[model samples]
Target: MDRSQVEIEEQGLGANPYGLLLKALTLIPSWHYFLAFLILSLVFLYNFLEFHFLQDLFSGFRGHPVCFTYNPCSVIYDAVVSKCRVLRGRYCATPWLSSPHLQTVFLNFNGRPPVFSYRRQLFYTSDGGTIALDWLMKCDVSGGALHMNSSISRNETTPIMVVVPGLTSDSSSAYLKHLAFNTAKHGWNVVISNHRGLGGVSITSDCFYNAGWTEDVRVVINHLHKEYPKAPLFAVGTSIGANILVKYLGEDGENVPIAGAVAICSPWDLL
Candidate 1:
């Protein structure tokens, strides 16, 4: 072949696009590939150990909570046992979050909570401490006017649920936000009773909330009852807040202002 033909044939053979990639790959050490594979395997194994798919698949459905009251023939048992869907229905947990520990961890780490815009009311306590009450009123209530003096005409009698959050939790907590949003959606007015020194309000006095402190809860309920005298008032307390609420009910006895109360995950005893 002539010089031109030889040059053209050589260039064609040498111009292969994959040749550069093959050369670069050849430079990588063999142990690097093994290390990469080992890291990937470790990650996969850790994730597999963290979430148990087999156990969740079989034990996702749980029984309902037991009903307790003064009498079996009382209206509470009749309504709760027969009509209340939450009491009568099966407690089916999400299969992915079957374990209680796993559920708590997942909720803390990556919970997807509903969005809310609350009308904040800062209440000063007798000891000069501050409590933030985040109210999620009805849809018709104007956003700009949430004060006691505002024109709340027909909705004055609407039921109100005062939610007291767990220790170190506030209205911004995922669980409390979900509870408030869901309760408000059902035509009831919901308010998150942020603990003293919590919910972005600074502590003004020496008074601080502990696990068994019930004075804060008592004052909040009484204030809400006084402000909306016609409105039926209810309270829901979770975790440390539950302890406070139960103690308040016991302390106040029949004089408690709330029409009903619910305490979730209350501790058995406090020292």
Candidate 2:
């Protein structure tokens, strides 16, 4: 009654470790599984609502009545609040215009001499990477011989316009050619800023250019500024190149050194 009863009580079937583990496993479905399901459901619902609201906002901007139908009270409140902020005094309605159109023409004569001698130059990055740049300059005249025509001079007062091409574009690009020709006719020196990999030269580093990476532009601008301190410098960029230019301008703000800049068809928001 003493030893056997004590052994039986110590090794009882009701005190099985495996049974306790099984009971705990069954309780997991009741609480833990429910909590996991609740969390996932909340995440999905939040994402869905966010997407729906954004879609409605975009639809409203597109003149669709979806936002008004879905959230009429909020839309009405916003409209009323915006209306109350209006000023009573006269405000100029006309948008600001920058430059005037000028009659421009490319040289049509085939017999005339070439204006500039084109040369390719290489620039090194801070990390010892190199990028090839093509530069065009008016030819130097010599005694008793006709050199390249001086269509534009790089005097102290002369204006230099640096043309940056879009993705995979270079100095030989049709747009760049047209721009160089036009600006040359107006007695402006032009240089074409080509990207690292796309301009027929192998990129030294693995780092390729993106939309807002204006380091190359900054380098070129610094070089030009050093070369022609008194000359006015301008830049024109197209497409992705335009994005780089705009980013540079915005980053530089009022401290930009260029005399002027022109960016066309630039995508301001990359994200």
Candidate 3:
């Protein structure tokens, strides 16, 4: 048996839970399909979402008729908006996907989209849950000459935006992917901070992450800060993820290292 299996057995993890999870995820086919239509709908589903959604894949829809920054006369209400150039298009580019209701429900169920580009990996938090992370790096660390190994999460210099999804959600959600894609375009490194176990991350401990469990977020934020000290770090969260981000910010107060943060649809009642 491998060392990992031995460790699992020693910890009484019951037949190596992570091994089983890894095996299952390996068989998880492409996200471009509906249930029971996997093999048969490959060609159809591919072209359907691929061709249709790929048009504004990076430039996704805008939220709220309140502020449509893509429109010339639209107001920018958010304080921490980016300096990136606005691509010429409607504020709500794809009304089909961008509608707040559609986006919210789709995000609630972890919907995937076309051109889902990211480097999916795992971040073992101090509290023990293996948080599934999707890294979309724009840093210029090529040739492996930066002395980076497979273990290193990122190299320095390029700014980063860490996105956290809410309960019952993961990085696969359309809304989260949209943000990640747009951030990647403007040369900002994007990393989706999926909650433990929601995004195919292997469960190692008996405990799973909870909304008020800000320790995991604290560790994640500190880790990111340490990994890319030279890079400006910012955070974005939706729903419960947003709640956690807010708590963390409040906990740290003026000492928070984050350059800025934006939390959309934060669940205040839960806290």
Candidate 4:
């Protein structure tokens, strides 16, 4: 451990340059290595969860709605969905508003719907309540020129479609307006059946419409049928309206005057 030994070590260090680096690493505390390992483990876990769980859940949550029927092999189902080119197209959501909740909020609060004109008709319910029916008799016409056949909207035999909006919604709702406008454009007479005390109409009767309310709809259908006996009558309902329509149809069965009906977003068993 004297001058001779020190000289020997210095000569060995000079020969191998890695000796200094190895000596410095040995002086570091063990805690530093442990902290580095912990950070690496956390990073790996996050990536694993993101790839295996989060991605699939988000993607599936935003998937397009499925078209289904009780009898999948029914000829009517195939003709309605498969043969219809417009309905066959898949829905592609906006990239930024892909989430269902974001899409709903944006559509309700921020979305812009096309404006159209309609003639409002108020019906007095038997129970002293009021119902509003907004009619789009001639929507495809612009500049006094008919885009579709004039007979489609003007003729007594033209088909008529009745629209029933969802709970807390009215004829002026964006979705109802869009549906009415589209149906009218396709040469069918469209009418929106706003619930009692809805569509800006005040509640005159103490009775209120609920999910199972079918009396108002029955009255409307009977009146429409009597008014236009030649026109084929059809109905489209959404949400609670859909539930009401289904119940009405079930109750009336063959007695219902509707030629056909469509129910969208019906909540059959939800509390």
Candidate 5:
């Protein structure tokens, strides 16, 4: 072989291009490899910290006690019972009565258009706090003058159903509207309890409500009970409202005034 041929053989270009590329990769700066290793190490540390320590800590404190006497297990038990399973002694009932009606009302204006009419009427609590409510009234032709917005009537014998909505919801919510419509079709009076700060009611106070806030509900129920002393009262609540209703019932113990209650999708743990 000549000198040029010997030089080309020494370079080994025709042997394997991938081998040459691998040799070049070894020559890469140490800083690049260090940075890659550092990124991998940080990712592993983050995952380890999150899964092993942070997750356990959060789980341990998931439902921290709100009151000294508050028993979370009781709340959980009530929630499970609210599901309406294990009828009598054994065997679950199909198509539970607590199931919410599947109907969606985007916006209901009663008789007026959305731009001109207000669906809910505001009322003041005993503590001077204000709350918005939607009423389903019954009519009578007797001498009694019925308030158009009140959820009571003079001659109607059907029981009243009060519905309390969850977070970020109001009387016009789909579930609330559906419940009202269904109960009304069943010849019953219905009312939707819109929490303070929601349902377009100007919140007069700076206080925000939580899962176990039942004072507002109690006040509303008291008003209804006084107004319709003979009629039965039933309450149904969803999500956070369900928790509040359950808590109220538990707190009341044997003195609960309402005939029956149904709670759906309640979160017993509020921490």
Candidate 6:
């Protein structure tokens, strides 16, 4: 074989440069090579231990393996999420919770900021008052205008999830936008219900939304439902807005328009 062909054959058989290293190590003492291998093994073991140790140290202990108290129910995976609640809230969490260890850790303690790139749609709270929503549409028409003027058919039964953030936050808040992004990715219609005068929307009313005030929220949910009757409506609220949502649910009771609701970290009894 030619010199080039022979060199190519050697490289093909030892892609990891084993031939060069074997020759180089031959010139060195056998004890030195053994010491080098020992060092590498310790490094690998130390790295492995450090990764798991640090993760456990930072993440804190997980929720009890047995779901809730007073019931001998052992292990979390067996318990249905909807079985127990703090104060008998309106919403029911899904049962059968299972996730990878690394995933659960990140999800529980994912402090990273959220990134949002939503197309907004404006809605009028009252005749003169208006609010802007970060719209996440999944219409059949790709890149078509889904602005306030664009007409999406009521026949489309998109699963809609409306998000309301904390008192100080808006559609762009890390928590709210993260949820909207994930839900939209799963083919659900997600929208952020920005409080009046917030989220870069122009303020037209003298009144700003508060923890107890569900008027604007009511209006937004009703308007969206009316516009898209075929689609199912679900609302999720955070912080003060969560209190408002619960109040709305309590007031409306069985007559509430939406299919289901969720409230998180609500200040129910703010004395």
Candidate 4's residue-wise lDDT over 1-271, tens digit each? 9999999988987775677778888898989989999999977865643333344356764544455445768877677766776554445455565456565677777656557666778998777888888887654534434344333322388789998889999987887877877777677888899998788888899999999889999999999998888899999999999999999999999999989999998996958
Clash-forming residue pairs, model 5: none
Ranking by lDDT: 1, 4, 6, 3, 5, 2
- Tens digit of lDDT per residue, candidate 1, span 1-271? 8999999989967886798678888899999999999999977865765644554456544543555445777887777656657654555557667456788888877888876578888998888989999988766233523334433444499899999899899999988878887787677888899998889998899978998788888888889888888999999999999998989999999999889999999877666
Cα lDDT tens digits, model 6, 1-271, are: 8999999998778776777787877999989989999999977865743334433434343322333334446543246454666423332211222223444355546746444457778887555788888786654123433333344578868789988888878877766767776676667788889988889888898887888888888888888888889999999998888998999899878776798788887885887
lDDT for 216 in candidate 6 is 82
Per-model TM against the reference? 0.69, 0.52, 0.56, 0.68, 0.54, 0.58
- Which ten-residue region of model 3 has the weakest summed lDDT? 140-149
Q: List the residue pairs that clash in candidate 2.
A: none
The residue-by-residue lDDT of candidate 2 on 155-258, one tens digit each, is 56678788878876777665576677667666666778888786678778867888878988988888878877888999999889999998888988877779
What residue pairs are clashing in model 1?
none
Model 3 ranges with Cα > 4 A deviation:
1-112, 139-155
* Model 3, position 138: C-alpha lDDT score: 47
Any runs in candidate 1 off by more than 4 Å, and if so which? 1-74, 85-92, 140-155
- Cα RMSD (Å) per model? 12.9, 16.8, 22.0, 11.2, 12.9, 17.3
Looking at candidate 5, the ten consecutive residues that score lowest on lDDT are: 95-104
lDDT agreement with native, every candidate:
0.81, 0.67, 0.69, 0.79, 0.68, 0.72
- How would you encode candidate 5's per-residue C-alpha lDDT over 1-271 as one tens digit per residue? 8999998987895678899899999999999999999999977866644323343345553422222223546864567544544332332112221112211221233322211122455778766678887775433211223345444454456788888898777876655656666566566777788998888777787566778688888888888787777888899989899998989999887676798898887886778
